[model samples]
Target: MADIQIRKYRDDDAEAVKEVFTLGMSEHIPSSFMHLLKQPPTQMVFMCVFCALLASSKSILLPILAVTLLLAGARQLVSYMFNSYIDTSLKKDLNYITETYLEQKNSCFWVAESDGRVVGTVACLPSENLPECLELKRLSVRRSHRGTGLGKALSQTVADFTRDRGYAAVVLYTSVVQTDAQKLYEHMGYYKIREFVIPELAAKILNFTLIEYRLNVQGD
Candidate 1:
């Protein structure tokens, strides 16, 4: 770990972060799941809401509703079917840094480098709506570097950054399915604040729960 150095993301880091992001996603969720997630926002949300309406209503519009649901479901199926044929691609981890850095706010990225390569990264962005809360995201470590305390160090760096910005608290959300992430948050002094899920996907997926975790940075 001596060779591992953490530094802020520069414009040159864009492509590197994208590569890391892709690597992390490929190592995690199934390709099928990523397909549904990557669907066009308009189509995805429309189909989700369409399903919700169809489940609750049974009236003269049932035929139209049924057709829409069938089409949406078929689209989802097609998306998954063709997903394997495309060249390998992964979610861009640069999303976190691009969002924050572009805002010109107190948002930043920390890259863990070793042997002249980026092994991991953590990103933090101050909450615009909730001043006391800092939003942390995109904490990822390469597979070969796990269990070497890099994650903890990345988290603590975010905590320190939040404290330095005079924030009283830090807040983040992670899927309940990620038990390891929950454990890490708890270990970092973040307590479970609430558990809820968006009504649309709540019944479609496993567990269907999202946990909000928070930590007091100013000891408040």
Candidate 2:
């Protein structure tokens, strides 16, 4: 913590920032796959397929193999979903951090550096859907640097930025799989405003949900 420095995003830090984000998002693949497996639809389909295969082939090995393959495929789908999001973000705002968060009004990006290497990132911008509110996005900390109050420090950075800009509140969205993030935001005085499933065929089938949380800085 003594070596960590939180400051504005710089051009040279682009690659490091993206790496932190990609790695952070990739770390959730296992949990997301587990979440998919726990869904009722996923369980029902796997059970039906396994029973059908077992009855038809009259071979436990074959059914087990088939189920294992299905599980692997499901895990691949979860990985694909997370990878796609990473790619999209890279191609979008992340690809143009300076313009998206630095040059714009009421928008900014920050990175945490430790011994001259970027280890964490967080950004905020005016919310598209919520008036007088700023949306916190891209909050990520390197795995090796987690559990040292870095996440809370980054979150508080956003809250302080929002308050300084006269924003009423700060809103952020995190997937249901990110339990730790939810807890961190809650501990920072943020409240759950709503939850919604991603409107994609695969996401809908898997019941993938995103939760929105809001921290009121104006009143506090």
Candidate 3:
């Protein structure tokens, strides 16, 4: 779409901003669940053992029922953890967008508008976890708007902000599942410097890791 405007978020854009972020994040749940299921310790081991029990035993009803319960439990556990993450994150940070991302001299939230609607979002602020660097957060683009250069535009916006302010670097974290995001970061000259295992059960079961990427900035 033409006229893709990247500007600071306004008061009226709160609802749209929340919607894009929520929906964008929710899109990963299905893939995450599927990944968890394939892990040998989660569903695969149980299923295999249940199958063996059924084949060898004459009275299989009770054993098969137990297997069914076990499988259901594993599935529910993943669901609960993912939903809890969404809830806690929204309450801890998303609800205070203005304060967390928009109020400080070094912090800003930006939305991408095309045809008078916000289809993408991004934010950056001084890193609390890292010194002398800015942290990029919540970079999301609606599905229909992907590959239209909005992602690059949003990223460059944060990099420009960091460079202008003479921050030593700009850093971000993305899940290992987000291949597209990794590609974009690398294309933009960001490189993976570290990786940390996610603390959630579902994430650990699936071997999910969070990759940290950084772009060193120089003053002009």
Candidate 4:
């Protein structure tokens, strides 16, 4: 509820922006691991492994230990997936915020600063897959700053930027594990456009899905 300032991204804010994004993305690992656990394939594999070990070794302790190890491995996989994504993002547009968003035509990035510290970030650029529509990306707020409307304000920053540029709509992709984001976007008038499984082998095997949402600002 403090006075939060939303302004154009600056070069000096690079480290803060990356930190916000990394922390935000890291927060989802637990949920993603749970998602993996809920997958039928994962459940079946765990059950089979546990039962086979129990029958062969005839020791409940060994089977329990094996199952525990498998669970730890699954959690590690989830962490790896999230970490890889964070690393890729840092090496991509985030690595060149000025060039990718600030200097590019019809593209921009903004950071939300509270009490002189960068606490949130959001960016928009012309969508590659949807002509005349801007894609909202890199929306993140520091964990300590959540529940204070920072996320909603960052989202509005992207929407206002898109509308001012005469874009038809704003489109974004959020993974299934990001339930709070799905709610936030829907609450802000973004409608679900479609959902599709990520094409990567690990994602495909785990049934990971990304939901696309669009907010029509043409007539608003």
Candidate 5:
């Protein structure tokens, strides 16, 4: 988060927001463009040929040809998707949770930006079906930018947000693999309340175990 100016998201922030969402992960590349370029030589040549065909002068059915060639181009790039293991299966689960949480209109979303690049984000949701509790989700800082207190800043920001919204407690879940994050959560006053093999936690156990932590925001 690195002294970022935090604020609500704008429509122009789609790409930056996606970048912040993916930060601090070994499997993640800067962009899908980078992910495409890192492919093997054979795949690279295939992509080049397809792009050439896409720009050919003798093309009458260019649109159809483009779609056909693009599918082939996609096949060449499909391996990258397999190479990256999406921990937490967070993409799908995140979308689901965000949608549900937003429907209630009780969650807050914050984005951190530094030098025009988004480096971090924190999101809060009312916990489960509980009206008085909140769950912090998607708190992250870029790997190259850790130890700058963005995590704590996001936590405190979310805490204040929940308090302002009248929530009595704030809770969140983290992976056992993320020791630093667990420590940070604890340092920020979140306690390990329950441990279980829920879908998201179970997905992490395939790579590393996970624990759920809760913080009593009202107590503060």
Candidate 6:
């Protein structure tokens, strides 16, 4: 965390910021894919096949697990449906970070830089879901920088902005795959206000729940 500086977004930072974001988010695909594989549908298929062949030997369990892991790991990187959103956001938002985030009256973006390289990012903008509250958006800390308190630093930037601007509260949304993010938000005094599962077939099978958290800026 040496020489870490959190400051206003700069025009030249778009590429580095996008790189950090893309890489940071890509790290979740492995865990998320594994989560998907552990769902009822995938599990039932794998277990049914394994059970059908159990007569072959008691030593098949390790090989079955290894194969399952390999397939899921491959899908994590090659499944366009599972990862297009992250790539889309990078192409669309990073290209217009200023116009999308920095131009709004009550919105701003901050990047955490260490040793002259951007390592994390966070942004706050007026929430469309709640007009009185600010939405904390795109809080990303590089994988190498986790456990170093970079996440709290980035989140605090948004909280500080909300308080300074007299916003009623701060709100954020994270998916079920991001369990660590849920912990971080809760640790910062955010409370889960809503949860809903995606209606898509695959998501329904995986039980992909979208969670919304809110923190009162004016009180504890």
Q: Rank the candidates by lDDT, best first.
A: 2, 4, 3, 6, 1, 5
User: What would the C-alpha RMSD of candidate 4 be, to one decimal place?
Assistant: 1.1
Off by over 4 Å in 4: none
Q: For every candidate structure, what is the RMSD over all alpha carbons to the true structure, in angstroms?
A: 9.2, 0.9, 2.6, 1.1, 11.9, 3.6
Instruction: Rank all candidate structures by their TM-score, best first, as comma-separated numbers.
Output: 2, 4, 3, 6, 1, 5
Tens-digit per-residue lDDT, 31-108, candidate 2: 999999999889999999999999999999998999999999998899889899999999999999999999999999
- The lDDT values for all models are 0.69, 0.95, 0.85, 0.92, 0.65, 0.83
TM-score of 2: 0.98
| 81-111 per-residue lDDT for model 1 (tens digits) | 3343122322333544555554557787888
Which candidate has the top score in lDDT?
2
The C-alpha stretches of model 6 lying farther than 4 A from their native spots are 49-79, 200-202
Write one digit per residue (lDDT tens) for candidate 6, span 89-173. 8666777899988897999999999988899999989998799899998899988889999999899889999999999899998
lDDT per residue (tens digit) for residues 1-220 in model 3: 4778998988888888888988887787776767766776766678777877777786689668878887677677766766777788678777788888877779999999988999999999899888788999989999999999899999999999998988989999998768889999999999899999888666676677799999988842
- When 3 and 4 are scored with TM-score, the better candidate is 4
* Residue 32 accuracy (lDDT) in model 1: 35
How do the predictions measure up, each by TM-score? 0.67, 0.98, 0.87, 0.97, 0.63, 0.84
Pairs with steric clashes in candidate 1: none
Which model, 1 or 4, shows the larger TM-score? 4
Quick one: best TM-score, which candidate?
Answer: 2
RMSD of candidate 2 to true structure, Å: 0.9
Q: Of the candidates numbered 1 and 6, which has the greater lDDT value?
A: 6
Error of 5 at 39 (Å): 33
Q: How many steric overlaps are in each model, in order?
A: 0, 0, 0, 0, 0, 0
Question: What's model 5's overall lDDT?
Answer: 0.65
